[model samples]
Target: MTGSDAAGRLDDDDFPAYTMGRAAELIGTTPAFLRALGEARLIEPLRSVGGHRRYSRYQLRIAARARDLVDEGMAIEAACKIVILQDQLAEAQRINEEMRGTASQESDLPPG
Candidate 1:
């Protein structure tokens, strides 16, 4: 990849730019914690060609939330479930709002 290609990836939140150790350090957690999150199916890191785990900014954010809940005495599995539910709820709400907006626009049109 060229310099421009690498530079642009820095701004891509989904780019798997961080190794497992770096990801753990950035989040102020241990590799074991991140592994647990992966085991729980909360955040699946991409694997490099050599089979090493590579984390994206988006996965790190999810890991951070899981860490927060775990620090508050919640079990890893429970935290994962909550995070999954929260994300699902947010997406559902966004879709509902979009549908509502479309329905209102349709209502505002004259009957055929």
Candidate 2:
């Protein structure tokens, strides 16, 4: 791949650029914690050719949020559930906002 192609991947949140160890370090958590997250079906990391797990920035963000909840004494399963619900709610809100914008634009046009 070209230099620009690789550079663009740096801006891609879904790119699995971090190894398990690095991901754990970046999120200030342990590998076991990450493994537990995987067990909870929170986030699944992509496996490398050699069978090592690799994580993306997006996964790290979710993991970090789960870690926060866990730190607050929440159960792992419950924390994962809450995070999933939060993500769904955010997506729904975004869609609603977009629909509202389209409706408002349509209203500005002449009635036909």
* lDDT tens digits, residue span 5-96, model 2: 99999999999999999999999999999999999999999999999999999999999999999999999999999999999999999999
Model 1 over residues 14-106: C-alpha lDDT tens digits? 999999999999999999999999999999999999999999999999999999999999999999999999999999999999999999999
Report lDDT (CA) for all predictions. Answer: 0.97, 0.97
Model 1 segments more than 4 A misplaced: none
What is the alpha-carbon lDDT for the whole of candidate 2? Answer: 0.97
For residue 27, what is the lDDT in candidate 2? 95
Badly placed stretches (over 4 Å) of model 2 are none
TM-scores, all candidates, are 0.96, 0.95
What TM-score would you give candidate 1 relative to the actual structure?
0.96
Worst 10-residue lDDT window, candidate 2: 29-38
